[model samples]
Target chain A: MMTALLVMIGLALLLGIVLGYSALKFKVEGDPLVDKIDAILPQTQCGQCGFPGCKPYATAIAHGEADINQCPPGGEPGMRALADLLGVEPKPLNAECGTPKPKSVAVIVENLCIGCTLCIQACPVDAILGAAKQMHTVIASECTGCELCLPPCPVDCISMVPIPEKVDNWKWRYPVIEIKSLAV
Target chain B: MSLFKFHGGVHPPEHKLKSTAAPIRSVTMPLRLVLPLRQHVGNVAKLMVAVGDHVLKGQLLAAPDGMISAAVHAPTSGTIAAIEERLIPHASGLPDLCITLNADGEDRWGDHQPLDYQAQEKSAVLDALRLAGVVGLGGATFPSHVKLRADDAHPVLTLIINGAECEPYITCDDLLMRERALEIVRGIEIMQYLLGAKHAIIGIEDNKPEAAAAMRLACSQNSISITVATVPTLYPGGGAKQLIKVLTGLEVPSGKLPTTIGVQCFNVATAYTVHRFIDHGEPVISRVVTVTGRVAQPGNYEVPLGMEIFDLVQAAGGTADDSNGLVMGGPMMGFNLPSGHVPVVKGTNCIIASAPALFAPQPPAMPCIRCARCAEVCPVNLQPQELYWFARADNFEKARSYDLFDCIECGCCSYVCPSRIPLVQYYRYAKSEILASDKARQAANVARERNELRLARIAREKEERAAKHAERAVGARAEAGGDAKQAAIAAAMARAEAQKAEIVPQNVTDLSPLVATEIKAIDARRGKVDDRD
Candidate 1:
């Protein structure tokens, strides 16, 4: 009986040492929880979530200091995705932040553009191309439709326009009806 | 040879006799032709002719833009009227870039030479096919040259010719086979030579006994060891995968091509086109389109590409008074066209003029009774009801997990659904949504990468500026005096700190005042705790 008890204690001690060694051997460098939360948040960097960027908001959420519903640009779907990842109940998007809107990309009216660089600086994706005192244009394909550049245009030349659907971009519309020949 | 059978399929009514009963006739040339740049899938062909330029018949109008695109040729000698947005054949009824040409009626030919495939290198033959605007004529309109190109990994074994023509009211292939069997056999020989395939099989439906007999006779006359295997007549048995399954007993895995399994499939009409282009010095400027349903004279016509469907329908004795709608393909798989004015594209196989009595109006869709009849007829063996539920709810992830993309949009599920639910439409909606979202996600990733690079560039620029300032200050301090070295260092350190404070990335927004205050408070509380410890 004494020998069996001693063997059990010895096995427990060895397992504990191995577990401690493994903990140090393969340690992850950064906070993976923050990374996962950041992945769930839309990287709009619009500051509509009251944080500096998506990363900061994600970090705040990881630290238990921020609610998961603070993101407005992410909308309810984004909130639910985050809630699923964080194992929490999804809450309604915080009204203190901006309301969700349809995606719109910034379009600069070249004739009205005052050649100011403020809008260019405000763009998070660096999608605007122009020099000072020259006409600026937004690369539509690259623009995230974030609407962040609108506030920085001193001349109000920048406008958020909904992306137009082309023939190729169109999805099949529903409720197809079948018509047969009556005179046959 | 024995034939293999596929899992699930439906046998739709074959009304092919309405058109195939007569011989194929050439349509009268329309006044103008409107050719869309994006006729054969892939990227839109780049325009090679400008407005007002006169082009001859078979003149290259648009060059292939990329590897997967097909070239566009003028259907007849004409003056380029306009290169503007015009309505083309599509489900959406939207306008896109098209070339409008007014035919001069002379039918003048362009400078061209027929290629001797046997004498030329394999690569040369493939290149000629690409230059001649050859593509699969089996509705998908994929570039044919890409399929014929030899792959080192999957050595070709069997080449399957799709003569099944399973869709009801579509008999263009059947007529082409009965008329041009020898030409198709020659094309098959050329494909076999190009692919180095050991065997070739022509798969036709049992309903087309004449076509099968003619093809078999042609195969024997040419001494080409091609087998004409007749598959069971079923809706979508004509599909590349289903035909492959039926002929070779091979199930092309989901998300893979037949070429990956040592096989390649092509439409018999595509084979005929290739033969014409290679042997007769012609480009694909026209194809045989079946015009039936509600017309006085329903028959197959060799219609020129870019001929408006209205002209084709009018050539078929025009639509009857009872006709209310037009469908571009067969009754089962076709979409309703908004107008007959849309130009005939490379993929226009059949046009059906619909009337209230011919295609009886469906009752309002009743709720699915969980009867699972749709699942029974799905050619891809997908749970159509489950897919319908997920698609209607906009839960695309679940739909994707259920293999939504595997659906070939054959309309078998929709055709068999007792509730009259448009199951294929829902699946199409889901598939398109998934594709669009995938594209959006790709764009987002690109933007993210660009944003990261911008931040890195800003940091680097700030560092360079700080280094330049420090260098100038050091030079100034050294030139001033050795005794003022410590003061100079202190001044430089303060300036560097200030520069660091000012050099913030533009993409990162400033924190809100409330959050900033809260963060500061937390930091202070942590400091106090550390002190107490």
Candidate 2:
């Protein structure tokens, strides 16, 4: 009986030592999983998902503190991808954040810009190019059309416009939706 | 040369006799010629002539924007009335940028000079071909120069000329082979030399016996290593990959091109056009197009590019009273033209005047019973039934996994479908949706990248501004001399000391009794354990 007790104690001690060593050997600094989740986000920094930036949202997602469907900008495909990655069921985008809309880019009415720097400070992407007391312009190519700058622009010169489709950008039109025909 | 057969191909009835009996007749130049800038599958040609500019025959209206595109030229001496949007002959019925030329009726020629390819450099010959606006006269209309380009990594072992005009009611290629077989052979020789190919194979459907004989005779006369190969008469046998498979018994791997397998294919009519451009100094201004079905006098005509289909139909002894719709290509692959106002482009091989009697309308669709007829006739050997299901349900991921993009849209599955599922249409829809989604993802990625770059740029700017501010302050102090620097250092040290003095530690005596008792117990337990050790 004494020998059995001793062997149990000895095994427990060995297991504890191994666990301690592994804790030190495989120690990871910071949450690398959060970074991975962040990499998949659109990075608009729009704050529509009730977070300050995409990184915070990614951190929440990694910690299981937030649902993957909260991002409307990412749309259904993005949600599906995230769900696949997380091994969870895909859900519809959370309507509380916003609905997915057609892609657009911010355009500034050049004549209407009042040389205010508030829009520049509000822009998360720094897409606005200007200096103090200078006319601000949105770099259409760089702008994410997040609409964050619109709220801060006192003059309200910024507007979102749909990108025009050209011949090179034209895609095949979907045919008339018809069921299988009986004709041969 | 021995030929091989492909999988699951249907033998469509060849109606070449309907138009092959008549020789290629040249039609008079139309009053107005409308040339769409994007006739070929590449970047649209850059506009060279502005509105209201007088141009001569063969004058360049637009220059090729990139290597994959072909130049656009004036079919005849004309004045540029407008460089505006016009209806292009596509299934979408969308308007594209076009150059409207009002013909001057002079029938004049420009200063075009032919090059003796044997004496000239290969690159120079390719450049001449590019300038001549030569493209594949086949339905694909890919620029000829791009195909003839040599690749050292994948050397061309054989060049196959596609004479298999397998689509029903399309006899342009057959008639061209019969009339201009010698010129076509000359073009093939030039291409073979350019590509440095060891052998050239001319693949013709067995249905066109006279055209095949003419090509064989022409090839023998040339004394080149060219073979007039007879392939089985099957729909889509003229597809580049399909013809390559038949001629060389090789399968072009999915997502790869025939060039990767040391083979290149071109239409026989394209070869004839190349000969005309290189030997005669003529541009691709006209092509033989078969106008049959529901017309009073159906025949092949050498119609100039940009002529309206309405005029072409009229030239074919006018459409019959029963003619209701017009199809720009063959009945199987062609789409109904929105109207007759659309102009003929380089890819317009045949214009079938479709009617309810001639081309009967399909009955109501029935649900798929999984009969597998579509799969049996699929030339690419895809599971058309499964693809149809996935495409209908918008399950693009599954469709993509099944290699949906590899579908050539030859309409073979649709033609053979027992349920009349319009399988190709669904596939096209799925393809477009997938493409659109991919584009969206790309746009999103680009936005994210730009945003990240912007963030980095902003951070750098902030750091630089802080550094500049510090540097400016230091420079100002230095300019004030040594006394000022010493005084500033003393002030900074005093402020640091004052800030440090503001922070004080809380006294241990202020702790609550409960916390103090817990700390004492913890300390006593630790002391007892230390003593035991």
| Candidate with best TM-score | 1
The candidate 1 chain B region of ten consecutive residues with least summed lDDT is: B504-513
The CAPRI-style docking tier of model 1 reads medium
Candidate 1 stretches greater than 4 Å from native: A1-5, A174-184, B481-533
Interface RMSD of the candidates, in order: 2.0, 2.8
TM-score of structure candidate 2: 0.85
TM-score of chain A of 1: 0.85
Worst 10 residues of 2 chain B by lDDT: B443-452
Writing each residue's lDDT as its tens digit, candidate 1 over B14-40 gives 888899889899987887999999988
lDDT of 2 by residue, A1-184 (tens): 9999999999999999999999999999999888777766777788889997787899999999999999887889779878988899999899999998776788889899888889888888778898877888888877777889888888889899987766555666554655666788
Task: For all candidates, state DockQ relative to the true structure.
Answer: 0.49, 0.32
TM per candidate comes to 0.89, 0.85
Calculate candidate 2's fnat: 0.45
Error of 1 at A159 (Å): 1.9
The candidate maximizing DockQ is 1
